[model samples]
Target: MTKRIFRAVFLVSALALAVGLAFLMVVLYQFFGGQLETELKNEASYLSIAVENDGAKALEELPEHAERVTLISKDGDVLFDNRADASEMENHAEREEIREARERGYGQAVRTSNTLAEKTVYYALRLENGDVLRISSTQYTVAALLGGLLQPVLLVLIMVLILSGIFASRASKKIVKPLNELDLDDPEANETYDEVAPLLGKIRNQQRTIQQQLSAAKRQQQEFSIITENMSEGLLVIDKQTDLLSFNSSALRILGAKAAPQNQSVLTLNRSEPFRRTIDAVLAGGHRTELLQVQDGFCQLIANPVLRRGEVAGAVLLLVDVTERIQRENLRREFTANVSHELKTPLTSISGFAEIIQDGFVKQEDIKKFAGKIFDEAQRLIVLVGDVIKISQLDEGCLPYEEEEVDLFQAAGEILQRLHDPAQERGVSLHLEGGHIIHQTVKPILEEILYNLCENGIKYNREGGSVTVTVRRGEDGAEISVKDTGIGIPKPQQERIFERFYRVDKSHSKEVGGTGLGLSIVKHGAAYLGAGVSVHSEPGQGSEFILAWRGKK
Candidate 1:
């Protein structure tokens, strides 16, 4: 703005100065030409009179500054010349001024000299003797006039330039001062030019609009942060340039990133070859999924390309924790293997004994004994199959019995009565204690729980050891405890005791007359009833399994 204003002022001033100087020079030129013409006319009048009175002798008496004088006859011949020989001069009768003087008594003309450097004005008068007397004076041309004024013109131009520069500087500053001091943030509040008010108002409106847009954007960013921070799955967004655009807290935790990873390359977060390849494939418009073992657990990384106009613009990474799922799959595989082994053992024995009887390999008297052995093996197979089916149903969370209110103590007593013969056979004493404790649960699941606990107690007991069933109301809810004075489980193996087919002493599994699913049933049944089960045990101090009905309260 300052430059433009200064330039405009300077240009206008220069143009005006040029025009004024040109006009002044033209006026001065015309004024000087008129004065020179009048002086030649007067000089010709005086010289004509003097020459007529004294003839050629009067020319010698003429003043020195009175330039060239000429005498011409009526017959077109120069009679005498003061500046050159009369014989060598051109015919004066044919001259422009003399020709006009012959007809009009007096005449005037101007012409340039032969060299073209000087201009001469001619004035002539016809004397009383019928001859023309002419006076001429040389005047400088317009070029010569301009040359004489060059120094003065240059001085004036220099003065004009200086004045214009000073004026332009002051004007430019004056024009820009208000704008420089203006508070653009609050444009309407400033006191400035009325012409600039519209621009200021526009600035104010745009400022307000910008502030509102910034505030809304900030709010949106905060909402996105909150949602992603609370998510359990890791999320990441990356651009096509391999720059990370966004990273959530879950992603940071999953990648074990110590700092926020925005605007960085994905390789900086995870430099592993597989991770880099997965990102590359996704960026190339492909979808990829891979499992990575990270600090927290196994994470399933799923990279999906984000498309724009049928081209890959970026990608989104979803990280799901699959550690627990992998563990459960492994457990299922182990359970399948154990089930096949356990079922095959009894079936093989039953098949062998029946085949021996059918093939007549045994003696005739031993046929009944072999048949009895096959039946016992078949019964063991049936029990094992039944336990497998029950465990499967429990795992699927399918309850075959309806829930109802029942006395926990009564349930314990009934389970003890059912296990009395087994306890006696094992040489273990059975006892029940505690007051009545009622709970609302599935009756069959409760029965299954109590039956399994008591069976485990008697099955793993030492000879003459006692199994006690106790039920009572507790602070949290109903408590049912089955403690055994038996060959207790080792401390290290206690955690796996509730797993299906997990036996503390595999060598004595058959001797204890169990399929190793008794405690597993207890665990599942208690879980189905919304109860908690824990065990207190040491290697030689015996074990106490406690089932607490926490939901009943």
Candidate 2:
């Protein structure tokens, strides 16, 4: 705005100067032209006084200025033309100055010379003797006058433009100063501006509030980082631009990656099909669960919304390490299937034989043996079904639980008495390690876990090998370990040992009448009781299974 105004002022100034100069030149031309013509007439009349006083003899012998003296007679005839023949000259009576001098004593006119075709200005006067004296000169027109002034006019214009540009540059700075001072970087300039004090004050207050908010946001970010870093699962946050803005250590470890990735599209990240589908689902407005199963194992991504002002801003993905859970679920499914299949065989056989027996299709001597086998199979079926139901109840926390102080030694002795027959038949030696103590709770579950663990140990052991049951109170918990000198589980199969229906050797296990629920029950029982189960085993080296529970004193 200021520049425009200044430019307009300078242009107007230049125009005004040009117009004023032109007008003044016109006025000076008229005044000076007229005054010079009047003076020429006066000089013609008045200089005759000096000539007359000097006399005709003096005029005839006129000094060096005689060239300007034109002697004319009273009767419209030239007496003596100082530079021309008197007789050859034309009549002067038709001349404006001569004619006017004759009529009104003096007059002036401009006309083209008859001989030369050049223009001239003439001044005339009536001499003392009624004779006329005339003088003439040429004057240049206005165009010629202006042309003569052109150089100086152009020089002045150039100076005016230079000064105008300098002033405009300075003025521009003044106008732009206020805007620059608002940056708050130049202390001196900022201090100099008090016009916008109110606005600056408000900005300062708002800045303070913003600073506080930024500090709070920073704290929240740090807190979230710490929480996710230590978490057992991975977490990923992506923005609307599909950039990976935030993540955690667990996420890095799970993805086999390191370093923080930001400002990159989701496709640029881990690009497995399942993971991409999960990202697409998140980009859409839906909660989805995508499971990625690879060679190492399974990972479950839980995508959720990050909302701001009731609108989704981005997505938060939880990368849960579900290898264990998936394996467990698969085991549960297999367990159910196995239970159904195992029971179906016995039931079908029993139904078929009973139907035969009912029809009296067998001999009386064979009836006892058939009945005995049927009863044994039926017993086995009952045990298997009962064990499955018990495990279900234990998992659901519906199993009856009672805590008490009991003697570990005495409990072991009682359980050993019941397991004696199985142990002897298998040629397995049983050893008791710890004495009685007050640290006991949930006696039934405790006994069940011990019995099932020991049974599995003895069942899977080598002939004439040993099964040792050691009950001791650890610093934080009660521990019971079942160590067996058996055909030990391989390193790879150790993880699946506690899974339902999993047998080290299916043929060997069925021959020994192993229900496969014993170890499964032990696993579920110990877990339901808020305990941990750890196993150490290698092929041909026997296995040790340890269960840890909170000590009850």
Candidate 3:
């Protein structure tokens, strides 16, 4: 702005100076021209008087002068010339000055020489002796005059230009100083030119608008940050340039990043192939979902593009921890295969015995044994099917049972009575300990849990071992623990004991003649009653399985 002002000021100043100088030169030239013409008239008058008094001899006697003199007769014959031979001079009667002087008594005219470089001013007087006397002076033309004064004119012009530039620079700064010092915070309050007042008012209005927009934007950013920061799932916002614009702590944790990565490429957080593919697909205006290994678990990455005017502008990425879901899926597949294998064994034996009888390959004396063996395998198959159905019901969580007040000690006694024959056959004694403790729970699920635990104890116990079922009131809940003098589980296998069809002693399982799902059913039934079940075991020592339910509200 200062430079513009300076340029404008300097240009105007220089132009004005040029015009003034030109006008001055023109006035001086005209003034000098008039003076030259007046002097010629005066010289002509004096020469005419001298010629009239003394004739040709008086002109001849004139001293050498800068002015030219000419004498011509009334008949237009040149009688005398100061700088030329009289006899060789042309007639002057037809000349403008001579003709005018013949008629008007005196006349003046200016004419350019043949070369057009000089102008001669002629003044003629018609004398009484019937002759005209003329005086003329030659001067350079206006163009020639200016050319001769060019050096001084240029010097003055340079000096004027220099002064103009200096003054213009200072003037421009002075004129713009008020604007520069204006308080933008209060533009209308500034003491400045009235011409600039409207602009200041606009500036003030614009400032207000800008401030309002900035405040609104800041609030929106804060709101967005709060929402994203509180999310449990990981979130990421990226720009079209692949730069990470925003993220949450969950995103950092999911990516296993040690620190918040600001203004960096999203790939810096996780460069895995699936993660990169998800980002790339979303950036191309597509939606993508990929399962990636994150740390020791699994994450489901969902990516979607952000669009503007039907164009992809950026992307939004969401990460969900699917570790538990994936583990459940794997367990389901394993359970299906194990159930098929467990059922196949019993079915195969039943089929073989039936085929042998149909083929008449069994003797009459062994018929009873074959039939009894088939009955045992059929019973095993039925038990396995029943257990599978129970597990399915627990998983579905829609059992036709309601919560009721159940006495834990009474429930343990009932379960022991049902297993009495099995315990006696296995030579394991059952003991009911602690007083009756009432707990609010689904009665059917609780009974199922207690039954499974006791059954498992008798089936897996050593000969002459004892099973103790205890019920007690805990600080926060009612507790039921089933402890057994059985072949203990190893520490490494304890964690997996609750898994369906899992067994610590595979060889012992065949002799026991029970589905390897008792502990799994115990776990599932406890869960349905909103209780927690855990086990403690050492390889050579007996095992303890404890189930605890929350106190009534």
Candidate 4:
């Protein structure tokens, strides 16, 4: 800005100086020319008077001067010349001054010399005797006049340039000082030139708008950070160059990264081959997913491509923990296979016995025995099917029952009565003890829980062993316990006993005559009623299954 100002000032000053010099030269030239012409006219009149008085001899009698004097005859012949030989001079009759003087009383003319370096001004007067008298003087041309003054003009121009440079620099600094000191942050508050006020107002408006936009952007960034930090699933964002842009705490934990991963390459976090391949595939405009065993558990990694204008810009990686889900799927497959095998055994027995009777392969006396075996197998199939249906309903949480206040003691008594025949067959004595402890729960679920527990106790007990049902009210809640002198569960298998078709003594499962879903039913039914079941047992001493419910106070 300062340089431009200085240049403008210097140029204007130099142009003004050049124009002034040219005008002075022209004015001086015209003034001097007029003065010289006037002097020639006066001299011509003076010489004419002298020659009129003294005849042609007056030219020779004139004192030596810078002016040239001449006399001409009426017939175009030079009579006398003061500066040159009159006899040898050319005729003056055809001269412009002589011709004009003959027409008028006096005439004047100016002419350049043959060499064109100088000019002469002539004034002619017609004397009374009909002779022409002329006076002439020499003057320099316009070029010669300027050449004589060249040194002085150059010296003055040089002085002007030096002074202009100094003034230009100082003026430029003065003009730019206000702008340099302007407070741009608060443009409207600055004290400066009125010509700059509108520009400053525009700058102030833009600054306010930019500040608002910056504040809004900062708020959004904070909100995003808060949300991602609190999320349960791992989230990571990367750019097209595979550099990590952002990541949540969950992502850091899932990847087991020991450092904050911002602005680092994705490979710096996890450089496993499979992980790299998945990221590469996603970044190439494709979506990829894989299950990875990371650290102590299983994670489902989903890499989705981010697109902008039909091109892949980056990728978003989502990691979901699916360890429990995987375990449940495996359990489901095993349950299905076990159920099929369990059902096929009884079905095959029934089919074989019935086919023998129908084919008449068995004698008449063996018919009753074959029919009885078929009936027993069919009954076992029905029991197995019913147990499966009950378990399915419990799992789906659609078992039909209503919540009500029911006495645990009474429910236990009813279950004991129903299992009397089974108890007699197993030679296991049954006893009910404890007060009438009232608990708020679904009645059917409570009954189902007690029946399965007592049944399991009787089925797995030795002959002449005892099964006891105890209902008691404690400070926490109502508890119903079924204790039996049965073959106790082994410590290692205790946790798995609640699973479907899991029998502690599988070799004697058939002789025990159970669908192998008794304890499973008890577990599910107790869970539905919001109760807890635990077993206190040791090998061969006995086992106690306790069901406790914490009723609302």
Scored by lDDT, model 1 comes in at 0.87
| Residue range 1-86, candidate 3, lDDT tens digits | 99999999999999999899889888998999899988888888777777777788988877786578888899999888889898
Question: TM-score of each candidate?
Answer: 0.76, 0.66, 0.76, 0.65
Order the candidates by TM-score, highest first.
Answer: 3, 1, 2, 4
- What does candidate 1 score on TM? 0.76
TM-score of structure candidate 2: 0.66
| Candidate 2 Cα outliers beyond 4 Å, as residue runs | 1-139, 149-333, 361-366, 400-414, 424-427, 435-441, 462-464, 473-476, 538-541, 550-553
- lDDT against the true structure, each candidate: 0.87, 0.77, 0.88, 0.88
Each candidate's root-mean-square deviation in Å?
Answer: 4.9, 7.1, 5.0, 6.6
The better candidate by TM-score, 1 or 4, is 1
Candidate 1 residues lying further than 4 Å off, grouped into runs, are 1-20, 27-146, 149-152, 155-170, 180-187, 198-233, 253-264, 271-273, 291-299, 306-313, 360-375, 401-440, 461-495, 522-527, 530-537, 543-552
lDDT of 4 by residue, 444-514 (tens): 87887888899889988999999999988756788888999989999999999999999988887778888
Least well predicted 10-residue stretch by lDDT in candidate 2: 184-193
Counting clashing residue pairs in each candidate, in order, gives 0, 0, 0, 0
